[model samples]
Target: MTVADGTARLCAPAPGGGDLGLWQRVIDALRTADQWGSSDSTGTPEIWAHITEGQR
Candidate 1:
């Protein structure tokens, strides 16, 4: 996924019957880390929230 110009774009390969739950967990982990930032000292939840808004 990429966010630019106030819009977010996502591109991925067609599902090959993989484990969607695992993919969701990976995405969730990434989002959580982005919210917390490095060492939990520079979180940007607001920006992340805006970028990820409406995204699953």
Candidate 2:
């Protein structure tokens, strides 16, 4: 994904954990984003919420 400023965001599989692993990868990517500097501390639950929103 590319932000308005042209920064490209990406997600990649980590090798073993499948969807659960992808969550971590996505969180790591989000944490590194300039727009989301503290994603580790703040964005995890939000991310998981979005990810699992319709599964229930």
Candidate 3:
């Protein structure tokens, strides 16, 4: 997950069985805290940019 500028990006592995609901809850909790926006795609350029920005 990436949290920045009051927004969050969640990139989690595909859950198996009944864990989908559990994952949703975790994402909801993160959104509640950030309140700006959210996305679940790991390939998003913005998310990757934010992640790599700190490495350089």
Clashes within 3 Å, all models in order: 0, 0, 0
Top lDDT hit: 3
Tens digits of per-residue lDDT for model 1 on 6-44? 555443333234789965664675574313222223442
TM-score of each: 0.29, 0.31, 0.28
lDDT of 3 by residue, 3-45 (tens): 7864445544444457878768755654443233434566442
Clashing pairs in 1: none
Model 3's TM-score against the true structure? 0.28
User: Per-residue CA lDDT of candidate 2, range 1-56, in tens?
Assistant: 33334344433322334578776776676654444422245434233112222232
The order of the candidates by lDDT, greatest first, is 3, 1, 2
Q: How many residue pairs clash in model 2?
A: 0
Q: What's the distance in Å from true for residue 14, model 2?
A: 16
| Global local distance difference test of model 2 | 0.41
CA lDDT, candidate 3, residue 49 = 17
Provide the lowest-lDDT 10-residue window in model 2. Answer: 47-56
lDDT of 1: 0.44
Off by over 4 Å in 1: 1-17, 35-56
Give candidate 3's error at residue 29 in angstroms: 0.3
